[model samples]
Target: MPELPEAETIARALAGILPGRVIRSVTVLREDVVAGSAPQFGAALRGKRFSEVGRRGKNVVLVLEDATRVVVNLGMTGRLVPGPGPGVPPASTHPAVLFHLDGGACVAYDDVRRFGRLRQLSRAEWTRWSRQLGPEPLSRSFTGRRMRGILSGSRAPVRSLLLDQRRIAGTGNIYAVEALWSARIHPRAPSNQIGDAGAVRLHRALRRVLRAAVGAGGTTLRNYRAPNGNEGLFQRRLHAYGREGRPCHRCRTPIERVVFGGRSAFFCPRCQPC
Candidate 1:
């Protein structure tokens, strides 16, 4: 799964190769790969120049010279070939679409599960959708006070609150557990119970965890990679997550795991007391 860090890494990696590049052809290998009619989707982007490529939350955004913007959501297994393109990955790669450039190079979207979504949006439309997203955790607007305010009076568990995209965009299962552990907060603690000091600690922990992960390329548990096909190195540095029953890195206490919201939550019981 390409969460915010993965998506952000991809955007930066692709920006080095995509911008100013002219599209020679667009091949929507699957009808569903492109949002609307595959033919129409290709026609709109073909021959256009890529002005900018970026990320908003977990979405990869492409700004065309003609002002048409394309947003790609890598649902579960969607992967993009950066730079000079991936000639042709193995058949098991599940290639979904292709973007051929003016040169012989080409980029492709390979999705094993086909859960990703692609959308074409005008400036106004894209802005409208962006407005729906909550404050980016990395942005200056998302401070500890803001985080506390968002969590105030919420009946949801702190873990569920962290997973909420509307409160903090880009934080998913992996980072949420890790951040909670780093903050020494129980995963199932009530959001309302996280007092002022706890809120500050949680906010700082979240930002620190995300920044470090992004800098290290991101955590690759499954199908994640940078646009250039580089696997993330952060998994090796993870303090929690996927470490169930293993000794905690700091406390030597056995890390416990729980199933919530269809995902596993890993934490050191002694470090993060209820």
Candidate 2:
């Protein structure tokens, strides 16, 4: 899944290039990939000019001149790439949707698994939708104290709590594993048992890993690319999450992998004690 860093990178890149560009046309090659009426989706976007581009959690927010918002959730294998407009051929073999912009520029939304969604919303609807999400992990509102509060009563695994979008928006499996490893917290540690000290460490680790990942353009294990079709560099900096049986960087113990809820988690047994 494209997580916070990936979304942030794309939004930042689009923010620089999308504003003032008018949508010359809309192409829905895969209607099932769209959230609402396909025809209405196209009608709402065509001829509209982008006013801003931002990100909330893992979703890309595109605001138009008329205050309309388009939210894109790049579910599992989605890529939003920018390049020459439609006739020139998109970066993906078959893009789900294409936003044909002026000046021969274009943005393509492609998902190999067809699990991503593109939705159109009004200003009020956008506000309501955003409210349902928890505080942005990178925002001031998600302080260490706030993180402690989030963990105060939950019995779920700390890793699971971090993966909860309603508890910490924008955190996904990979980042959760990385942050837990960084904080020296075992993935299966009960959230409620993680006292203030653990919460504070986790809070800092989350910010550090996420900020670093954003700077590296996000961890691209598979199918994730920046708006310019560039692969992220953060994957090389990974300390855990895929280095099973590899020597731990800190204690020289072999990193181990565990599976819970059908997801794999990697950690150093000595570094992240249960």
Candidate 3:
């Protein structure tokens, strides 16, 4: 699954090319991808101009001229591709939706697993849906003090707490392991067990890893790709996410893997102190 940085990368890329383009028509290849009634999806979006493309957590929000927003959650194996011309081949694997733009550009949403979703909402109603997310780690509101406050009362493992969307948005299992490894913190360490200094280290580590991942175009552990269909390079730069039994970069200790919440978490036993 693409996390915050991946979603943000896609949003930024779409923002560059989507705004000012008018939607001439919309094709729904799979009905399940449309969150509401098919008539509602077509009626709300067909002739609207795209005003903006932005991201809220892992979801992409496309603002239209009529103040209607198209929200997309690109679940695992999902890809949003923008084509050069109208006759470009449709995404055959799992092409769910296609938007024909007045500018001759076409954007297709594809998800091999058919788990991604698309929904149209009025701008006024989007706030209600967005309220469930916590602060963005890269935003001004996610300060060290704020993170410390959130972790101070939690008894959950630090990695588990970081993965909670209600506490901090955009982090998933992959980045949680990477961030904890970068901070030299164990995955199973209690959140409250981390000292003030440790909290500061974690806050910085999270931001650093996320920013770096975004720069590298996000980790391509599975089917993640940029708008141009290029795989991310961050996976090559990962320290411990999927390198189980590999030697640690900083120390000679071998990285270990364990199951947490049914997901595999990789860490260096010696470097990540409990």
Candidate 4:
């Protein structure tokens, strides 16, 4: 799935090319991908100019001239590609929505597994959708105090707490494992068991790993790619995730993989002691 960094990268790239361009028309190739009525989505967006692009959690928001917004959650394999000309070939193997722009450019929303969604919403509606999200990890609002508060009473594993979007937006399994490993904290450690000092360390580690991953254009373990269709470079810097049996960078201990909540977590047994 395209996590925070991947979604943010796509939003930044789209903001550069999509803003100020008017939507000539919208085509819903896969009806299911359009969360609302296809006709309603098109009617609300046709001829409206895109003013800006932003991301909340793992979703992308396209702010339109009319103050209405288009939200896209690229669940798993969704890809948005900007094309050169009118009637350009679809970018994804299975495109869900295609936006024809007045400038002769096109933005294609493709999802291989048909799990992604596209919805048109008003500003109030957008607020409702975003209200449940926790503080952005990259934002100043996510302080150590806030982290300590969120994890203070939870019996859930620290890894599970990190993955909760309502507590810390934008972290997924990949970054959670990486950050926990970097902090030398075992994934299975109960959240409440982590002291304030430990929470601070985990908070710093989360910020560090996320910032580094964003700088590297996000990790491309599966279908994740930059808007320009390039793979991310952060995978090369991975220390624990997906490095099962490989020597740990800090302790040279063999990395191990364990499944928690049916999700694979990688860690160094020696470095990230339970």
- Leading candidate by TM-score: 4
For model 2, the stretches where C-alpha displacement exceeds 4 angstroms are 85-89
lDDT of each residue in 137-183, candidate 4, tens digit only = 99998899988988897999999988899888899999999999988
How far residue 143's Cα lies from its native spot in candidate 2, in Å, is 0.8
lDDT of each: 0.85, 0.91, 0.87, 0.89
Clashes of 4: 0
Q: Candidate 3: TM-score?
A: 0.96
**TM-score for all models, in order of appearance:** 0.94, 0.96, 0.96, 0.97
- Residue 83, candidate 1: Cα error in Å is 6.1
In candidate 1 the C-alpha lDDT for residue 196 amounts to 95
Locate the minimum summed-lDDT window of 10 residues in model 2.
84-93
Clashing pairs in 1: none
Q: Write the per-residue lDDT of candidate 3 for residues 1-274, one digit (tens) a residue.
A: 9888889889988998899999888888888878988767876788889999988888888998888889899888778888856667544466788888885678999889878889898867887888888899999889999989988989999989998899898999889999899999999999998989989999999999999999998988778988877788999998998899889999969999989777888999999976
Error of 1 at 264 (Å): 1.2
Clashes of 1: 0
* Candidates 1 and 3 compared by TM-score, better number: 3
149-207 per-residue lDDT for model 1 (tens digits) = 98786978899988887777888898999999999999999999889999999999999
Q: Which 10 consecutive residues of model 4 have the lowest summed lDDT? A: 84-93
